[model samples]
Target: MPRTRPLPSNDYARRVAGQFISISETRLNTSPPRRLHLNVNILHSGFVPSAWRLPDADPRAFIDVAHYVRVAQIAEAAKFDAVFLADNASIADQIDFRPITALEPTVLLAAIAAATTHIGVIGTASTSYNEPYNIARRFATLDHVSGGRAGWNAVTTADLGSARNFGRDTVPVHAERYARAAEFTSLVKALWDSWEDDALVGDKAAGRFIDTSKVHPVAHRGEWFSVAGALNLPRSTQGHPVLIQAGGSADGRELAARHAEAVFSAAQSFDESAAYARDLKSRAAAYGRGPEAIRVLPGLTTIIGATEAEALRRRDELVDLIPWSYSLNRLAGTLGVAADTLKLDERLPDDLPLPGGGNGNHTFFHATLAQARTHGYTARQLIRALAGGGGHRVVVGTPEQIADDIEQWFKGGAADGFNLMPDALPDGLQDFVDGVVPILRQRGIFRSEYEGRTLRDHFGLQRPVSPHASADSGLTVNA
Candidate 1:
């Protein structure tokens, strides 16, 4: 076969062998080893509702940019993955006693992004109240400004108080909200994917700034939104801002399966958290997505001290600071029972029913009940267990003990990671970073230094391809 095409030579065999090894390496690189992820929740004061009353706590810190910037600096120094800011349209907490979710999330996060270099900035936005186009542009702008360290926590406004703020007398029905959310989220993603990856053509000599042909209108007319134009801004550095979701209702689960890249969940027990992970991943597979596509991060509040005894003492102090009337009222609100009916020393009512007619926080109501039932905890005990956060699980112990619990949850498949909410800010978080993070690092489950420059990189997520581009590249536009 000394013709035009000769027989394979030794050189050809060597090249083939190199290519096979290259392919294997590529696969290995794409699937990074599983590790623990952490994001700190920067609620006013801290996770403990009365943390502002602590000696070093600032009364006006909720509105102070300096306080947030200081926390961001600490988190960045520790190589934390992100800092999350949760929002609600109306006052969700007791304003007179402690700060509420006061600042607009995206706006506040914009300031945080300026002060920090690498930590991811995430904020909540309600799909039920926002226009898809506006949200798409806002998050895209944030991604671009932050150099791709931006995430959006998608939620439907959960209460009638929020509805009243928007001029509606009643909250939208549960099904209606989810239906709108699914469509709204889909439309926002479509708008993000409207422009092709090659759409930006900056040719200074020729004076052609963009390739108009590569840009297309989304033209979405869905049940919830009617968006006609392409996004004014170009695609951000990360392609699209990372999508984060939080909800526990059945409809909420389905929506997360279809769209979320990360989920913030609230489960009271290890078994419950693991079950939720399984169910969500299975649903995602049914939607033609891989099980590894989404990361499940359940909320974990910690009260850490030098010793377990001191940790319990600190928790007792915080619990004492909270007026019993407020705890009783808050628990009553979650259980949808009368405040007078709930005695602080007694266990939750055995015959408790789900909130009447879906007019409350469905996820946390169920979670709170489940925890109470599982532990047979009294109202006072449950109040202390939650550390003033309505349904988030609380862990009170020394730094070593806290690290052990986190490891158990991560290795046991109870969580992909945790959204850590320390009992107090700056100081509380500082203790975890200085104490607990070292243990995680020594165990080889958390990163000692950031591996990538973007939020998706930090999460080991792939940059999405333009849906309008060729199918051979792996992305397809369904809308």
Candidate 2:
């Protein structure tokens, strides 16, 4: 006899959550909350390079509300754990080559929230350009609007172009940006916790709605922000939106160690990923947090096909869709080298060096080079295999092969979960949901069903306990 737990149905939303996640025995034989978490980072207008041209793809997806709605619906139908959106404060060099879905992320996610039900909504916002109170309030509103399914991807805008947008001539130095980020995050969280979880008494008969005595101010006098008192909104359902960070530098890792509940990272190999995970966990221990407190999710972009040959050909086709000049400029911009210096077949020029005076983005440059050398690729072949500027690792294969790769990575301790981005929207994602997902279930790796409601629950993260507590609680622990 299988024991059944109540699904997080909309009807039972208050007692459960506004999600219909059912907890039951998995075919993989897993119990509650052990099921794997999956989040699709919906790269604006879809992840595919030619998504806008697909038969079902909306030609105006880059700016159409319905286009965004359609994609979110697909993810919801597939029972994905969440949908993520990324943002930049300003224009980048590649807008001419590609369409930018630069709609305000919070507004966009709010639209997404209204368009779909039961899928987590994550939006990227930079602490470098945003004030803490505004960010805190915006995310809080989204959480309430979405019935508790909101997440925030905290970022320190790295591109120099973003500084001018924020009324600065240059981006702040990496460490200074991170320093502000840490303080910014801490103050924002304090605001979220300013009012006790049960502060909203809702005592309609008594004509009292809030317990003012239970609320306090966050008088934070930090170097960058001096916020006082409470956040305008009450404590969100998740306590605070789940904190996700996506920088892979040393300072980035340290910041994640201190605060992030999940990490979005890029690593070329299993060994590198495993080591990086180990280092992050060690750092978390320094902050008095356990390994379980944070999750590491690597970017995994997959191109699927019924046959391995077909998959490879599909990947080749998309690479061909991108203009050579465009790919070259992108690679050049990232490599900190001129487009003229790079050759189609020659080894990387001896003069090519790292950026930011040694605090460069090592992950991409090294990952690209490793692919070229190990795979014996020419410049064209390398760029094509790299997949659309090749920021994340690219995998193309039959469904079974893709599942095998993911299973190995998961079991190998290289990642707790994967942040999937398809080469194109809808179709790219459709193949994954229809193909790889089933095989992963057969292999006893990915989940066939949801085991919990909230995104935090999906990730097996506990609700954040209040920092404000009875004096007796802290004293008793100290004693």
Most accurate candidate by lDDT: 1
Q: Please report how far candidate 2 places residue 199 from its true position, in Å.
A: 0.9
Question: Per-residue lDDT of 365-423 in model 2, one digit per residue for the tens?
Answer: 66666667666776777787777655678888999898888888888888888888887
Models 1 onward score TM values of: 0.92, 0.89
Cα error, residue 197 of model 2, in Å, equals: 0.7
Candidate 2 residue pairs in backbone clash: 47-423, 48-423, 48-424, 217-229, 218-229
lDDT of each: 0.84, 0.73
The TM-score measured for candidate 1 stands at 0.92
Displacement of residue 300 (Cα, Å) in model 2 is 1.0
Per-candidate count of clashing residue pairs (backbone under 3 Å) = 0, 5
Off by over 4 Å in 2: 1-33, 54-56, 358-363, 373-376, 471-479
Write model 1 residue lDDT over 52-103, tens digit each, in one string: 9999999899999889889988988989889999998888766778887788
Candidate 1 local lDDT, residue 306: 91
Those runs of model 1 whose alpha carbons end farther than 4 Å from true positions after fitting are: 1-30, 471-479
Q: How many backbone clashes does candidate 2 have?
A: 5
